[model samples]
Target: MDINDLRSAVTLVSLLLFAGIAAWAWRPRNQAAFEDAARLPFSDEQGGQS
Candidate 1:
């Protein structure tokens, strides 16, 4: 394939990968996990524990 064809293939693959990740992140079952992650920065842990 030519350079143009290779570029198109890469773009299509990147788009598909992004869509798959978006779908996974938006699924209802993952809502709780995502929320917990969103709260991590505000948690009150003082320091890293052993």
Candidate 2:
């Protein structure tokens, strides 16, 4: 396809990818995991032996 067609396809794919990630991140099932990750910086390294 032409350059314009390729550009449009890439943009649409990127938008869909971003929307999917956003949905996944906001889903209720993942809330606890995301919250734990958000606390990584504040957690003590000794107790945080992953």
Candidate 3:
């Protein structure tokens, strides 16, 4: 009802939304690019050897 309450509610909603998005993004079907990126440093290291 007050400004402080409104601010708290908005903050809680945004936090929940961000958590949901993070969970969706971490699902297995969406992880291949993330895995590839995780491996990129190693790939670059190998490329530098040759």
Clash totals in order: 0, 0, 0
- Give TM-scores for every candidate, taking all chains together and pairing residue i with residue i: 0.84, 0.81, 0.59
The TM-score between candidate 2 and the true structure equals: 0.81
Candidate 1 C-alpha lDDT tens digits along 1-50:
89999999999999999999999999999999999999998797787667
Report the backbone clash tally of model 2.
0
Q: Give the local distance difference test score of model 1.
A: 0.95
10 Cα displacement, candidate 1 (Å)? 0.1
Query: What lDDT tens digits, residue by residue, belong to model 2 across residues 9-50?
Result: 999999999999999988999999999999988887786656
Top candidate when judged by TM-score against the true structure: 1
Which segments of candidate 1 are over 4 A away from where they belong? 45-50
Q: In candidate 2, what residue range of length 10 has the lowest lDDT sum?
A: 41-50
Cα displacement (angstroms), candidate 2, residue 4, comes to 0.3
Model 2 alpha-carbon drift over 4 Å, by segment: 45-50
Q: Score residue 24 of candidate 2 by CA lDDT.
A: 98
Q: What is the lDDT of residue 11 in candidate 2?
A: 100
Q: Could you arrange the candidates by TM-score from highest to lowest?
A: 1, 2, 3
